[model samples]
Target chain A: MSDTRTSAGVDNFAVSKKMFTWQVEGERSITILTAGNLATTQSLISLLDERSVSGEERDPSILHQPTMFQVARLVGATLREIIIGASETGQTSADQFGASIIVGGQIKGGKPTVFLVYPEGNFIEITEDTPYFQIGETKYGKPIIVRAYDPKMDFADAIKLLLVSFDSTVKSNLSVGLPFDLQIYETDSFTSDRSKRIQADDPIYQAIATGWGDALRDAFQKLPSYKV
Target chain B: MSDTRTSAGVDNFAVSKKMFTWQVEGERSITILTAGNLATTQSLISLLDERSVSGEERDPSILHQPTMFQVARLVGATLREIIIGASETGQTSADQFGASIIVGGQIKGGKPTVFLVYPEGNFIEITEDTPYFQIGETKYGKPIIVRAYDPKMDFADAIKLLLVSFDSTVKSNLSVGLPFDLQIYETDSFTSDRSKRIQADDPIYQAIATGWGDALRDAFQKLPSYKV
Candidate 1:
């Protein structure tokens, strides 16, 4: 094994090599692809923290204050604490020496955002046109997110969508087993009550688990198969 | 955040939860799924060291021998050592804390396996028809494995699928970045030489990345939109 260290610091939000493509109402909107590295996070935070010449950190005089790095730091710190606690208690195990966190939401006056947080206390926010967030072993669950996500989705819909996403991940990755803790807050509601921990045997989640697996198999069967 | 320390050990020829899953052909083939706290790495080593009916400790025998817990210890030790090294290099600032390992594979003549290695150096394997493995922010990348995994898949195909799976994960989770280290060995290959470090800018990977994202969007657009 190569001696590569898998630690994310404040400055190292490595953008995924993958490009994110989306089409809305027959129009294509492709943002320049970038990973959530420390530089990107810092730049974003700086833009968000910029006040019109006053130098006041939290200046309200500006019409739009961006989400600062401090905000990212605060969010990263919260997630770090959560994962640390989880690891200590044996709820979640780290792989190759790291945990994963997805922290996304709109800051006041900013566009709705999404970010994927590394175990090293760093983050990357998703942009508006592509408004969704995913963490853990996510590929098994990504198709659903791509198929179902909508910018106008209400918090309820978003939470359900996220649950489905989590369900897909759990089914595919045993390391990411439940009970899952989900929290969904409205854009402006800083404090919300839409958080729930869905256990492995939770009824609603069970329905989703069985329903989705069956639906996927059925869909696969319906698709054209390759000729031998 | 609940405190629950669950541990399991695989004895001589004994498989742990690290490598259990159901394989899908016309039916599901379950792999490993042993459960118990005392069944951990230390206990398994002790069990292996025990004398046979001849009152003499058996030599290291691969036949009917249990998978080694030393593998988990190695992975954990590697992670901890890397974290320490990174901290000394100023690449990590999080005080000597955080990290985990997911170690799993098959022992010769034993069932193929999987395990989630904790920071404390214990592990559990997966046994069942689910003949695959994953580590890191695995939640985001698991769906593809569930939908597309076939136990009889050629090693090439399986590795490709895993690459794509990892692609989805790196895209969705910041903690699991690349250049990714991937290794694929046939059941009997004593050494894993198929291993390669995947960087973000690799051309073929770039193609898969763009293709997957585009395919997802195309499929999404074709889906019937909900009438909210």
Candidate 2:
């Protein structure tokens, strides 16, 4: 889950789109969640789009990558190139072009993979020890995920976990806010079973936020009281 | 609460102090929690100590400040001055002098207040709308506080709340480790009733962390799972 809210110096909705996907029917499927400067991320995405659309042979587009690792490499390289170009053109410092992305999915017969691409053009793939990865303002919502993660967790439970995570982040930080873009791609499936935007007033979102808050309070009360 | 663990490319135990307190019998009491850089914070604290001990009478030391507001101002100014000096001496850039602090306590005949002092020598006080303040890796621990805070909460409950908050933070970030310094000052008492360091194997810390994790898993199970 990723929120649509974006802000600059003052509160303004300059950009909202932060989720993307590309699929080749039954051959491949991919999903990406992005965070950081809008212009830099958008440019990176646009570059990928332009490259894939050219349909030229030997293009380093994500669509043409043979494995998920290569896809991560292509994305990381494109992001770094955009940032370096921005710096060279006096757009901003390389550090000022800060952005991070979480890309996950399966491509054809390859096992599913998720990778977090960093600003330095280096990347790390999620492993069994760290089965899930988060980008952007990840800390606020991370505690619950760390405590409750299960390797065999079902899609429904995963969405609940993510919603609770996103909701906590939205409440604590202004940079990330409501109406998240959500997608779920089942293993071996070339398409997501669900892909939609969760609006502020969405019933499930409301329920999860309220339910989680109440449940936390209840759990807190159950803990042994501090010795006076 | 703050952890004692430290890291610089790798984890080690070079610094552990993260909390401090000062008191004037039957007059005022204050506690501070610091985060960011060790050098800047230690220098800032040392400056305050030197000024207070010099007895120059004109020194704007935090110990001599009549009100908590003035105390905050003095601390902020001291921190800013140290940062500026560090920059001027080619130690690092102004931004590289990054640090932040949380100061909270009550003065004689005054209601308790908490202030978050910024690196820029400016500060903001805690309000009824935001009753608590946190410094250093606050996001991982913030959701619990946001949900659990209450003006009328008892001292024991409040301590429980902070422990839970701190535990969550310690579990998620290696940079914020344990052997946390804890202190509690009740209203009208110029001295704390409880103050101690919680070691790595401290039963209370371990119990809270384990019990809270179990409670969260239980809570997750109770939430109506999303339909596939």
Candidate 3:
């Protein structure tokens, strides 16, 4: 990210990536990537089913159906090939391989799942306790998640929270400018149900951004200052 | 610097070498560690004069006075020697150079100053525009400064802001634990008039922290949620 870029302008230094997965049936699985690299993205998918990496000890009582490492390996290999091909064609680069995938969805008998895929091909799943995943300049929007996030929140609430989160991040960090690409998948749906690329001037997002900032300033002013 | 060490515990690390100088009059200086180095318990003094590092061209209209490179070199050399010696004695390590020296006060005709000395020995001054310096886990406390910091703020106000800043960081990051060493230096005062180690149980600090968190949560709740 160039230091010269101001917070006001929309500048894309490198691509930012994230993936999400949903499970429809006990046997069926689907993965979505912000940028296509199935091999690297698959590591995230496998993380969901892998119990050992979840920091959870082996306990039959917990009823863990581990994510298949074989699936992860397959995904990783595919992503490596895709990245290599993109590099050769000058469409992507080894250094510019920037993307974070949020993978979550139901798989067969198991409940719905979600995971965060890092650039280096490793992944961490979001348990029921920590239900959201954010990549790139996450601080400005974190307060919203910290306050509003609850495991029982429905998909609609999640989408609202995500938009607010992205809005705050975009305001604070120039590297994370938009047009933002958003994809929403319902549980049990193999296909992407809704997707949109939100531009900088999108009306709804602009409203949220302005409103959040003004609200923050007002709230701050209202807080009691130190009395010395 | 270890995560296992609590705020209440005494630091296991000890300084094995020391070098410092105190400015008394017109460039009057005395080297404290010209012979044998003092133990970690001995606090050293260092001066930052206009002859220090070269100043960046801010606005062409604004008068600039650069800090002396010699002062920076001396401070850096002393810190490096002490830190290395401590590490060799198994008290700390290259990575564990966590102490930060606040090297700022007036020198003759110059304004009072404040700086955060990095482990690498480099330093950045806190000017009127940027009025505070923090060495560790600065994120949580940043909002307070962003909202409250002003160049003309009184020293009392500055101290209050610093306490709030430190409070936020301590709450968020365990690595930046407290029993904080706070020193307040007034303008034109060559030596620190008030210096105190604030413990975890300090009542005033506790009240501010608890009050700030509660205020934040209250403000967040009052914000308008998504319309849809």
Candidate No. with top DockQ: 2
Please give, for residues A75-118, the per-residue lDDT of candidate 3 as tens digits: 44444544555467676566554445444445454555655555
> What is the alpha-carbon lDDT for the whole of candidate 3?
0.49
Q: How far does residue A66 in candidate 2 sit from its true spot (Å)?
A: 2.3
Candidate 1 has a TM-score of 0.40
lDDT per residue (tens digit) for residues B1-228 in model 2: 556665554544565587778778888888877888778888987787788778687786676788999889888988998888889977657988778988888887578888999999899997768767777778899999988877888887887898899889888877777777778767788886678777778787688778999999998888876654
What value does the TM-score of chain B take for model 1? 0.54
| Residue B185, model 1, lDDT | 38
Per-residue lDDT value at A189 in model 3? 56
Over the stretch A46-94, how does candidate 1's per-residue lDDT look in tens digits? 4433433455756541222345344456545644554455457565453
For residue B59, give model 3's deviation from the true position in Å. Answer: 37
> Chain B, TM-score, each prediction?
0.54, 0.92, 0.60
Q: Quick one: ranking by TM-score, best first? A: 2, 3, 1
Off by over 4 Å in 3: A1-12, A15-101, A117-124, A134-144, A147-174, A222-224, B1-70, B80-102, B116-120, B147-164
Report lDDT (Cα) of residue A88, candidate 3: 75
Residue-level lDDT of model 1, residues B92-139, one tens digit each, is 453434434345455544544456655444566556665444543555
lDDT of each: 0.46, 0.83, 0.49
